[model samples]
Target: MPRLMLTDEHWSKLRTILLEDRVYDKPEHRQTMEGILYRMRVGCPWQDLPDTFGLWNTIFRRFLLWTRKGILQRLFKKLISEPDFEWIFIDGSIVKAHQHSAGASSKYDEAIGKSKGGNTSKIHLAVDSYGLPIEFTITGGQPHDSKAAKPLIDMLPYANYIIADKGYDSEAIREQVRGRNSIPNIPRKSNSKVGNDDIDWCLYKYRHLVENTFEKLKKYRAIATRYDKLKANYESMVALACIMCWLPM
Candidate 1:
């Protein structure tokens, strides 16, 4: 079996999530497991993986299986619970995708179109006041930021407040926030002729934390480059990025 380079806590967490009861008797299974840990840490593409990690294709397949089975979500939820946050911030970042990632014609093919740059993928992330990630949603580059607003907001339980930009200033979203018994701290656009931007100025100041969280997430080379060819793998990279954030500095 390949070496486990993650910290003791992370390794233990991975072990619990993986549940050793599941067999890893085959060489491919062991390799793939190591390959995932390697990709998460090194943020490298499968094709660029080193030979000692075993077959890249098998690793990629295992990643897909884990993602489809809600393993990633379970891991993310566990990490999210570790943080104590009174408020959460929401934002999205576009990642430029290489042409190779566009070949897949799956139902979640949101990374195929052009955005701020060329073909790209949008990662909508929600983070708590301390920049700890709470939720993540993926959409095509062309998808509107507001399109993900309600879903991301809906994922959270009741909170003190939720902060977002003017893009999320829809009456529907405001209603959704109120429905959850949380204050919608989103500000209205300056151009909005309907209502005033009534968000508390002080609370809005902390919105930058989520922005910084996106900056940190993009620091990973794999995340900065969209090399995962598949949405699930790419999203796993995001989860790994969040996991790194949750760990002690």
Candidate 2:
């Protein structure tokens, strides 16, 4: 209950994963990880992280190290090694960018961009039947869902069916889903004469699973809005949230 996020139960499981490589260990490791989760929950500036967690700057540096090394991303992928794939849902949602997240070095790739809602970033996510996150990507708000469909689906394992909204109604996307030996459950556009006669209406309702996953992840304040200036750092933040979703399982 001290200013920390991970419960003892959660820490036990996460400890096993974080230390699995045995590459590095320290007495402060648990506190460091807690600090990371704490920041994710509150979206506070590193220097503002509560003192009960200790030396905010120290914790922030460790997080930056892990983010740079792709440790968090790899850990998330490891937790999702086996997912409920019988039916998978994919979709995207946009997050507004905080003014504090601006002014990043131009050398780093950034995801935030101008949109009808001002600056924003979109999170493209895929979820299993149980609404657990499987894979996700970040992009500027202006890009269409189809631009991210291929790489996102490519990272996933084979599934019996792939579900999406009318935004992904393109034949190319459907064919890509077919390439995975999966049936596509995308509804056609309103303007198109071709109807959704083939769509599995019953199962398509479950497409809300991905939306729910996004909803849950966004509950963590850091994820609800874009604060990280670098795309990789933002992705690492999202990966940690996804790991939290899988951890409860």
Candidate 3:
């Protein structure tokens, strides 16, 4: 069998969340889940999955059903029910969109846009103080970070502070963060009239935690580059990666 990413203990916790309906046998579902993780980690086409994990098509179909049902997002939500809300860090990162990721027929935006890097997608992420992901949204690469900031901030659980880089520096964003009852720790641009002296440089240093979270997530090749034609599929891939981060905690 291929090396499994989740241990028995980790799988035990996740199994409760993923297979709550019990449509498939525990062992079979576990194997198929491993198969899905294998594809996500290695960034391979479904057909390349090895026989040890069973038929590749079966795994792919199962993944599609779960994505449609929002099962992966639910799993991530369950894992993070009681997050460390003392400090929430928000940031956005751009991922190069592979040629294969294009060609969606749906009217909905696929979160893919043509930029200098060709086609690209942006992942807007919010992580807790410990550098663990709390929530995220995908957008076209051309969307400004501040553009996605409000929605991402609105979805966060109660937090005392929200931190981000200067790219997200804007009065409207600061107002949105304040509306959530959280102080915005974003640094202002040098050209801005506001002075930096009032900003908490000490707490601002922890802003790296969100960047580090992005680094860890990008370690999964599937997340480092977009390959799913539909935004829903890409969102599911991201939710699964976030769940993996919470598994060992």
- RMSD, candidate 2, Å: 1.4
lDDT of candidate 2 vs native? 0.87
TM-score versus the correct structure, for each prediction: 0.84, 0.95, 0.96
| Worst 10 contiguous positions by lDDT, candidate 2 | 16-25
Q: Return whichever of 1 and 3 wins on TM-score.
A: 3
lDDT of 3 by residue, 1-249 (tens): 777898998888888766674445556888888998998898999999999899999999999998898888888888885578899999999999999999999999999989777999999999998889989999999999998888888888878988899999899998888887889888999999887876899999998898888888999999999989999999999999999999988
lDDT of 1 by residue, 70-165 (tens): 676676676555454578788888778877677775675545567557888788988876778888887778878888787788777667888888
lDDT of 2 by residue, 1-249 (tens): 556667888777767777885537687888888888888999988888878777998998888889888889888887875678899899999899998888897775598878777888999999988889888889888889988788899988889999999988899999999988999999999898988789889998888788888889999999998888888889999999999988767
TM-score winner between 2 and 3, please give it. Answer: 3
Off by over 4 Å in 3: 21-26
TM-score for candidate 3, residues paired by index? 0.96
Q: Comparing candidate 1 with candidate 2, which one achieves the higher TM-score? A: 2
**Candidate 1: RMSD over Cα atoms?**
3.3
